[model samples]
Target: MLAAATAAVLLLFLVALVMMAAAAFAFAVLMLMAVP
Candidate 1:
């Protein structure tokens, strides 16, 4: 039961990380567009 809970937390963390990475990439693109 503990293992399952830990796995769930890790999965959520991974999802959050991916979302943050995607957001960062989008922000960078927007910044670049603004510069030009």
Candidate 2:
């Protein structure tokens, strides 16, 4: 039971990390387009 909970938490962390990375990438693209 503990292992399963740990796994779920890890998965959630990974998803959050990916989302943050995607947001950063999108922001960078928008800045590039605005500047040029």
Candidate 3:
């Protein structure tokens, strides 16, 4: 039971990390487009 809970927490952390990375990437792209 403890292992399952830990796994779920890790999965959620990974999802959050991926979302943050995607947002950062999108922001960078927008900045580049606006610069030119």
- Candidate 2 vs candidate 3: the lDDT winner is 3
TM-score on alpha carbons, each prediction: 0.95, 0.96, 0.98
Q: Report every candidate's CA lDDT.
A: 0.99, 0.99, 0.99
lDDT of 3 by residue, 1-36 (tens): 999999999999999999999999999999999998
What total of clashing residue pairs does each candidate reach?
0, 0, 0
Model 2 C-alpha lDDT per residue in residues 1-36, reported as the tens digit of each score: 999999999999999999999999999999999996
lDDT of 1 at 31: 98
Runs with alpha carbons beyond 4 Å of true place in candidate 1: none
Better of 2 and 3 by TM-score: 3
- Residue-level lDDT tens digits of model 1 in 1-36: 999999999999999999999999999999999997
Predictions ranked by TM-score, top down?
Answer: 3, 2, 1
Quote the positional error of residue 13 for candidate 3 in Å: 0.1
Model 1: C-alpha RMSD to truth?
0.4
